[model samples]
Target: MNDSRFTPVDPVDLTARLVRCPSVTPVEGGALTLLTELLEPAGFECTRVDRNGTPNLFARWGRKGANRTFGFNGHTDVVPVGDAAAWTHDPFGGEIAEGYLWGRGATDMKSGVAAFAAAAVDFVRATPPDGAVVLTITGDEEGPSKDGTIALLDWMRTKGEAMSVCLVGEPTCPDRMGEMMKIGRRGSMSVTFQAQGVQGHSAYPHRARNPLHALVRLLDRLASEPLDHGTDHFDASTLAITTIDTGNSATNVIPARAMARVNIRFNDAHSSASIAQSLRDEADRVTAETGVTFELQVDVSGESFLTPPGDFVRLVTGAVTAETGVEPVLSTSGGTSDARFVKDHCPVVEFGLVGRTMHQVDERVSVDQIRQLKSIYSRILADYFA
Candidate 1:
C-alpha cells in the first residue's frame, strides 16, 4: 500500500522506494503505479500512456490550458543486472550504505526520476505556480524504446498537450555532479554488408573468388578514413566494425559469402541518408574493382540534434552554479537517450547525478547528490516560471 501523507517530499526516500520495485525494461513492476499514486494526491491529473504493452506515465499540475508549461522527461526502467550474485548488495535491495544508495537504477536513473518528481511535487504544492508542471515518465527507455517516449509524444499531440520547454533527467555528468550537461547527442546508425562470391577448393588458385578478401577491403576503406573532425558541440564521428563472420567449417574450402557489420556514431556533419549513400558508394567501388557482388542493410536510430546555448541552457547553468558552485560545461559526448525523441517537440537538455556506476554491478548514487539535485531542480522551476 502507498503511504499517501501530505508531508514534504524527500528525494532519497522516493529513490529507495522506486529502486525496490525491480522495474527492468519492458516491465511495469509497479514503478509507474507508485508514481501515479504519489502524484494523484498532490493535485496532478495522472494518465497511463501505455502503448503496445509498454508502460508510461503522464502527469500535470495546474490549469489544463495554461499558457506556459515546464516539462521533465525521464525513465524508471533500469537495465538488467548481469550476474546478480556478484553484487555486494541486492540489485533490488535499495539499501542505504556508506553515504550512498546501493542498488540497480540508483544512478541511472531512478534517483533522477525521484529528484525531479520530489522537486515538482514540492514546488507545485508549496508555491503553486501559475503554469502547468508536466512529467513524462517511461518504462521502455532501456529497451527498444519504440513505445516509450514516442508513444507519449504521439498521445500528447493528439490531445493538444504541449510544453514551452523541457528538461530530460538523464544522467549526464561523467564524474563530478555538476561538471557537465548534455546540450545534444550524436546520431547512431548500424550497417551490415554481405559479400557474395563463388565457393571452391582452396588449392585451386584462379577457380574461386574469396568473398572474405572483398569484405576486408570494404571495411578497411570505411574504417581507415575518419568520418569527420569534431563539430562545434560534438566529438568526431566514429565508425567501428563490430563483427566479421564467414562461418566456414572446412579448412580447405573457400566460403561462398562473408558478412561485416559496422556501427557509427555521427555528428551534425552528416545525416542517415548521406551516410548510407557513402556506404553504398564504397561497396559499389569495391564490387567494381573485385567483381564481388554486395548487399547492404542499414538502420538509423536517431539524428544528431542541438538546442544551442540560449535562455534555457543559461537558466539551467545558473541554477547548477547556484546550488553546486560549478559552472557546467555544455557537452554532447554521450550515448543516446529519450531526449532524442523529445527534441523534435521542443528544446530539451539533460542533467542529473554523476554516472560513474550506471550499468555496472553494485550500481549506486551519493545520497547528498540526490538532495543537491532536488534543490537545483526546484530552483530551475522557480526561475522558469519567474
Candidate 2:
C-alpha cells in the first residue's frame, strides 16, 4: 500500500463513528450530520440537499464549477438488521474484533465513504490540487432511491455544479480486494402482471376462467427464453419470478384475480422498452388462448451502460494496481446501485472493499482492508489531479 507524506484522517475511526449512527434507509440518523461536521473543518463547502424527506450531502473542496472536478459517491443508509438475536456483535456498535470492524454498513459502504473522505481531506491539506474534489453522500440508496443522488444531481444542475468524472464507493469486489472493479452494470427492471377472470366453483372446471393459469404460463414463457448471449463487457440477461399470489383461501372456488411480479436484469443488448414489449406480447398470446384479461405495470430502475475503456478507466485501474499489486478485472456482474443514477451526469465506476458479508447477520469489514482502501483512494486523488 502507498503511504502518503501527510498523515491521513484515521479512516478506521471515521468508519467506526459512522457505523454507530444506525442510519437505516431514508433515515438521517446523524450520519450526514457527522460527515458534514468532519468535512467542513477541512475547508470543504458542505451543503445539505434534502428533498422529499431524503437526506443527502454535497461537499466540495474546491471552487464551484471547477473545470476539472473529481467526484466520489456513496451512501450511509443501511438495510435493517434482521433477527437481532442472531448477531454475535451489536449491529451499530462499530466494534473492532478479530481484525474486522463489526457493524451494519461496515462492508456495504460506510468504510468506503470513510476511506474516500479521509483521502480527500488529507490530499487537499497535504498537496492541494488545481481542480475540485466533490463528495455526494446520500441517505436513500437502500430505499426507493427517489430523492438521493438523483436529487443531488438535479440540484447541481440548477445551481451550476458539476463533476467531470465520478467514482461510486460501493462494494465491487466479490472474493478479494483489488481483484475486480465495475466499469458497467446490468440494467434492472420489474414487471407486475395482474390477470382477471371469472370466479366459479372448482367442481365445474368449464365455468371458471382461471387467471392463475394464464399468469403461470406467461411467467414460464418469459423465464424459458434466453435474453441474450454475453456481450463484450456484459453477461446474458436474466429473468426471475419474484412473487405469485391469488390470495384466495377458498378450497372449492377458482380465484377471479391473480397477480405476479417478475424482475429482470438485462444487458446492453436490450432496453426496458423491448423487454416490456416482449412481456406484453406473451401476455397477449396467453390472453387469446385462455380468455383471461391482463394488465401490466412496469418499473425500469436503470438501463445497462458501459464507460468504454478510456483515460478515466485507465486512471482508476493504474492507481488500484499500484497500490494493491493486482490488476483488477473490469466487470459488470452486480445488482443495481446508485452508479446507475450517477452515470447520467458523469462517467462513473465502482470500487471498494470485498463485499462478501454485506447485509448478513454480522455484516463487517476487515480493518486492514479499510486502511488499504484509503491508500488506494488517496493515490487516485493524487494521480487524478497530477
Candidate 3:
C-alpha cells in the first residue's frame, strides 16, 4: 500500500523536500529516506545498497533480469555551505522566494534527481514499460567516491543486475535550462612536482640552486603549450598550474625545495599515461638543464569517454528539441560526473538544469524549470519505450 503522506508526483515539491535534508557529502541527512518513502509506494522495489558507511539507494520498477533496463543516476550529497552568513536564505531551508527554490543542491542537483524520479514514478504508473526503470542515487559523490556508484556497480555485477542504457542527471547546462547535454567528459588528473635545491644565502647567488626558479620554468613550459587542438568531437585538452609554493618566509634564504601542482583536463587525444610520460620528459629535461631533480605524484580520477553521435544520442536530442524547441548541443565539455562510472556498465549521457549557481553561495533553481525538466524526462521515457 502507498503511503498517504506521499501524494501526487510533483518535481518541484519533491525537490524542496530533498533540499531540506542537509545531506552534505557522506551524510544521509534524511534525503534517501524521503526517496524510499516516495518510490516504494509507487510500486518500485527499493534496496539500500550501503557500502563502507556510505548510503546508496537502488530502485527498480520491473522484474529482475529483464531484457532491457533504463537507468537514471544522480547524487543526493552536496558540498559544504561555506560562509553561511553570506546567503540571503538558509542553506538547508529549501525556501521558495520569487519563483526560485533557494538552498544548497538546488542546481547542483537535488532538482535533477527530483525531476527524473518524479518522471519515472509517473511514467511507470501511467504506462508501464516492458523492460525496467532503475534509479541509482548515491550519498558519496561529493566525497572520495570510493564507495558510492562504484560500490553499487560492483554489487550489481554480483547480483546480475543490468542496465542497458543509462542517463546521468547531472547539471549540464551552463546558462540556460535546455542548451546543453554532455555526451562525454574530459579525463582529469593531477600532478604534484617537488623540486629539491641547495639552500644558501641570497647574497651568495651561484652557491645555491633555487628550486623555485626551476619549478616556475617547468610550469611555464607545461602551461604555455597546448595539449592539442580541438578534436572532432572534443575541445582541446588543457593543463592548469593550480599552485606554485616555495613556502619561504625569509627573503634572504633560498628555499630547500619548491612544490607545484598541475591539473589536466584532457580529451580522448591523450590518456593519463601519456600525460604522465610527458610530464616526466619535461621534468627530465628541466633536471638536466637546471641540475635540479624532481619528485612527482600523480592521481588519475577518470579517463575521457564518449558515446558518439548515434541512435541513443539522437533519441535524447530529439526529445529535448521536441519539448523545448531548443536544439541542444551534444557537448563533451564538463567536469567528471558519476556518468564516468556508468559508462563502463552501459552507454551513458548527462542532461539537467542550468548550473550557474552550483557550488556557490545562494544556490537556487527556478521552480518552472523543475516542472519543465520533469516533462522532458517523461517524454524521453515515453519515446525510449515507444
Backbone N/Cα/C clashes per model:
0, 0, 0
lDDT of each candidate versus the true structure: 0.93, 0.93, 0.92
Q: List the pairs of residues colliding in candidate 2.
A: none
Worst 10 residues of 1 by lDDT: 1-10
Candidate 3, superposed: residue stretches over 4 Å from native: 1-8
Ranking by lDDT: 2, 1, 3
The residue-by-residue lDDT of candidate 1 on 75-98, one tens digit each, is: 999899999999999999999999
- Model 2, 1-386: lDDT tens digits are 23365566999999999999989998899999999998998889999999999999999999997889999999999999999889899999999999999999999899999999999998888888899999999999999999999999999999999999999999988888899999999999999999999999999979999998888988888889888887999989999999999999989999999999999999999999999998898899999999998999999999999988999999999999999898999999989999999999999999998999999999999999999999999999989999
Over 4 Å off in model 1, which ranges?
Answer: 1-6
- For candidate 1, the lDDT comes to 0.93
Q: Between the candidate structures 2 and 3, which one is better when assessed by TM-score?
A: 2
What is the TM-score of each predicted model, taking all chains together?
0.97, 0.96, 0.95
Error of 1 at 340 (Å): 0.7
Task: State the displacement of the C-alpha of residue 102, model 1, in Å, after optimal TM-score superposition.
Answer: 0.6
